[model samples]
Target: MISHSRRHCVVELQALPARIGQIRRIVSAQLRHWQLDPLIDRAALGVTELLSNVHRHAQPDKTCTVEIEFRLGRLTVSVIDSDPRLPVLREAAMDALETCGRGLALVEALSEAWGARHQTGGPGKVVWFSLTAAPAPVAAPRPVRISSKPVREPARTALVAVDPGAVSAGMSVAASVGARPG
Candidate 1:
């Protein structure tokens, strides 16, 4: 039921500070290419937050995969890391003024929906966010000019022979409306 073609991109890299910025750029570029101009900023922010988490908290190593998929008028940006520990969403404390713990909060605010899921048949978990945007408008078909009039075909009736054994009784009853069987 998807009218527009879907797009997917995956980038595997060590979640270093430098690489996070690089992935942000790649995500932005891909969203632009998919004609999702409105989602670029939010998606970039979500990717940055997920990658930052991987860089700071993932175990075994800092390696991770950043995946971006667009389908059904929604864009999903996810990060998969070797750590199975899902991210904890801390409630914002009004008394605390720390700036470090606001990454996921920002992602939650900007995204339509966001969650983390344990990867099946793998050692890692994927943190993802969804953004809804209107699909790109379909281009109008070009108008063609015809120099000659369309030819008309003369109507003729043909007799069609039906085998009672070959056709079901229900089919024969339906075909008897206008069809003449010889």
Candidate 2:
């Protein structure tokens, strides 16, 4: 069951060069508002790559949905597009310096887990990645009292010595004279 505290944000737009940056900023802002600051950079990067893929490859339309969900101590960033093709993760070659094929590679390296799924009963697919957030610190359990006992008061009183000369300047002259010894 999904908890009521779960957070979710979604943006639907054409995955174009201009919209990618706007979506990245939106994703960053949502993560920040959710107090998932550590995930912002990675989430933004992953979303950028996913949207770029949509821009370059999605069929019929470049329109897509970007979704962010925080649940079960994990933050998931996903992009759903009209393209039916699942993404292929190309192995990073030792000497290749191509800029075009590194999107999924970077997503795999940065995310805890990543995958693509064909949308059920639909003509599109959803590509997603998850990052595990550090669990919130559990509050220490408070001590509970099972029974009560009679309280014992101190048997003696402590007397504190006071110096008359050390009294505040607000003291009346007559009161100071009366408090002093000849």
Candidate 3:
């Protein structure tokens, strides 16, 4: 399920493998609707990582709230779960063949800033990351040049066969006839 207001979207769901994919699609669509197409991939990936964390590690329940909000030239994605434990940014080396333990690291590399905190007056924690959003391009006004002098129309010119091309002898004699509107 999803609900939203201006510049914000919230989805409540069980963080199962199947539900995570659906949430990614929802997040992508929301970004596209807001004309933030460029942020779709990053935002979707960040949300996926957060949701996966909830599915893998959260205790007591798999239910979580996914929130995506845009404000002040930044896009923020958060996953709030009932577990109050904040996530740690693991810097320890992992096996080359390891497929897990790198989700948060990827989020950190992709986002401009990211962190987690315990929810105020709640039993859950919100893990969130923020990406810098570029402002939508606005059409710039074209510059106009004004001159005090009156605009001059182009002169019309025609070639006249002066002396009938010098009697067809090719004497290279021609005259230009110019005309101006009355």
Candidate 4:
């Protein structure tokens, strides 16, 4: 289940292996609804990692709250658990077979900024990451150029030329059409 405001969403659930997948889908759908399709993959991945951490390392119980917010051109995803202990970002593992300790590292690479801290109004800690969502700068429209000078064309008269400036300036310039010599 989820509760949401105009720019924020919250989900409270047990961070079990099964529930994690559901939370990911919820995040993706929310982003799509907000017209942030580009951010769906990154947000979903970051949320998954945070929830997995809650399931694996958080103590006491696996219950947690996930919050997703879009504010001031940034999309932030956070997971709050009862565990007071903050997570430490470990160095990247050297072996390809290693899979247990790379969650935080992956989050760091995917997000513009990320951190974990003790909750301001509670005992637990919230692990959060932010991705930049600023819209691309729009190119200004090119100014339309209206030429002040008029275009001149050769008159159909056998030996006459028309001055475009005189005609455009309300001056009359007449030329008699002559028969062509075949």
On lDDT, the leading prediction is: 4
After the best TM-score superposition of candidate 3, give how far the Cα of residue 107 lies from its true spot, in angstroms.
0.6
TM-score: model 3 vs. ground truth: 0.73
Candidate 3: where are CA atoms >4 Å away?
A: 93-95, 138-182
Looking at model 4, how many pairs of residues clash? 0
lDDT of 1 by residue, 56-134 (tens): 8999899988888887888888898999999988886222677676778888999989999999899989999999997
Put down candidate 2 lDDT per residue, 27-99, tens digits, no spaces.
8888888888988899999999999999999999998988889998899988999889998987762237776
Residue 56 C-alpha lDDT in model 4: 95
Per-candidate local distance difference test: 0.83, 0.85, 0.87, 0.89
Candidate achieving higher TM-score, 1 or 2? 2
lDDT of 4 by residue, 114-135 (tens): 9999999988999999999868
Please give the TM-score that candidate 2 achieves against the real structure. 0.70
Residue 113 lDDT in candidate 3: 93
Over 46-110, each residue of candidate 3 has an lDDT whose tens digit, in order, gives 89989999999999999999999999889999899999998987785245776878889889988
* Candidate with the larger lDDT of 1 and 3: 3
Q: Report how far residue 154 has shifted in candidate 1, in Å.
A: 66
Q: How does residue 135 of candidate 4 score in lDDT? A: 89
Q: For model 1, what is the error of residue 68's alpha carbon versus the real structure, in angstroms, after optimal superposition? A: 0.4
lDDT of 3: 0.87
Clashing residue pairs found in predicted model 1: none
